[model samples]
Target: MMSEWLVYPALGVIAGIFAGLLGVGGGVVIVPILLFVFTTQGFPAHHMMQMALATSLGSIVFTSIASFMTHHRHGAVRWDIVMGISPGILIGSFSGTWLAAQLSTRALKIFFACFLYYVASTMLRNFKPKPSRQLPGPLGMNGVGVVIGVISSLVGIGGGSLSVPFMMLCNVPVHHAIGTSAAIGFPIAVAGTLGYVVNGLSIADLPTPHLGYLYIPALFGIALFSFFSAPFGAKLSHKTPVVTLKRIFAVFLMIIATRILWGAL
Candidate 1:
């Protein structure tokens, strides 16, 4: 239990830094590690994946806020873009959680692993859509938001992996896209977390000390450290070279994806 305590908090620190650095909401890191931890603790296999996803999204609620504020302080976030896409994000995110609840645990894990592979591949290739035009109008942005929200919620992420790239495609500067994605993460996390809470409510055999799918102790531990570390990460993002950070993150994601794929199979 003591080791669990230490490990969960340490995950938070890493998640926070990643969220600030990449605007990924930290769930890319959080979900896999939580799956391993919960499985090792002899948690029920049937519920473990959902629990991990729920807890990861729950932690992101706070982490996103911390990261967003830090980025905002540096004037990187684009408020207009955030406003344009948020409504669709909320709707799509909530719907995605409902969809996830209907899937088998193994199915969800496989899906998540595949999605991670896609993200890692994109990053590794440094694929950037050529800027062919200006940012999309409101309806187009909202449509894109829906895609980002649904994919993110299904995979227990903050939508940054998709949103950042989409923003870049729209000719938004990379740094501003990252900062805006941090802002976007808050809404994705909030809607997705609430959806998980609601969907998991009817499970009669949930493990102890949980709020719906969320494991309370792990949530607290992860959120606490992530909150403090996020600001530092945000500071570092301003100083670090973006390409270097993306390459490092891409490698990390590939490793995580491979591990998850093995587990799911």
Candidate 2:
């Protein structure tokens, strides 16, 4: 038990550092780690995926804040984009949370496995830098935002994978796209966390130390350490080689996805 408690905080530090450095939603790491930890701790098999997703979303709340603040200070955030996406994200997140709650553990595991594979494949592709172009109009942006929110919330991710690609497709600079995606993660985290909390109210036999689906101990530990480490990640992002990092991340995601899929089957 003591060792498990120690591990949770250690997981937080590692997740935070990666989130900061890579701009990943942290789900890429947190969800798999939580699945391993919760399963090892004798959490009910059916509840493991739910707990993992909830814990991951909960951790992102703090990590996103730190990341957003860092990117904001660097003038990478596009306020207009955030505003355009906020409403759709709020609505979509709630819907996605409800959907996740209705899913059986087996289904959720398969879903996550597929999602991870998709993300990994995309990340493995080489991306060329592009110039920013004006989006068609409010309607188009809002349409994309809704999709991003729904998918991101359901997957327990920060929408960076989707949002960055969308921005890049729209001709936004890669740096600006990344920064804006980080900022957007804040609203997605807030909305998604609230949705999970509300949805978890109806679930019975949740593990101890839980509020809704969230494990308070895990949440507290992740938030505490990630808050400090995310800024460091932001600094590293500027200096790190992005293509190499993406390749490394892609390999990591592939391994995790295979493991999760195999475990589920």
Candidate that scores best on lDDT = 1
In order, the Cα lDDT scores of the candidates are 0.87, 0.80
Residue 141 CA displacement from its true place in model 2, Å: 2.3
1-265 per-residue lDDT for model 1 (tens digits): 7887899999999988877675555888899889988988998888888899889889889878877887799999999999999998998899988988898889999999888888777877878777667888888888888888888888888888889888887899988998899899999999999999999999888877898888888999999999998778878988989677888888888888888788778
Error of 1 at 212 (Å): 0.9
Q: Which 10 residues in a row give candidate 1 its minimum summed lDDT? A: 18-27
lDDT of 2 at 132: 56
- Candidate 2: tens digits of C-alpha lDDT, residues 66-96: 7777678989888888888778877787778
Global lDDT of model 1 = 0.87
Separate clash counts for every candidate? 0, 0
Q: For candidate 1, what is the TM-score?
A: 0.91
- Model 1: lDDT of residue 163: 90
Q: What residue pairs are clashing in model 1?
A: none
Angstrom error at residue 141, model 1: 2.2
lDDT (C-alpha) at residue 54 in model 1: 88
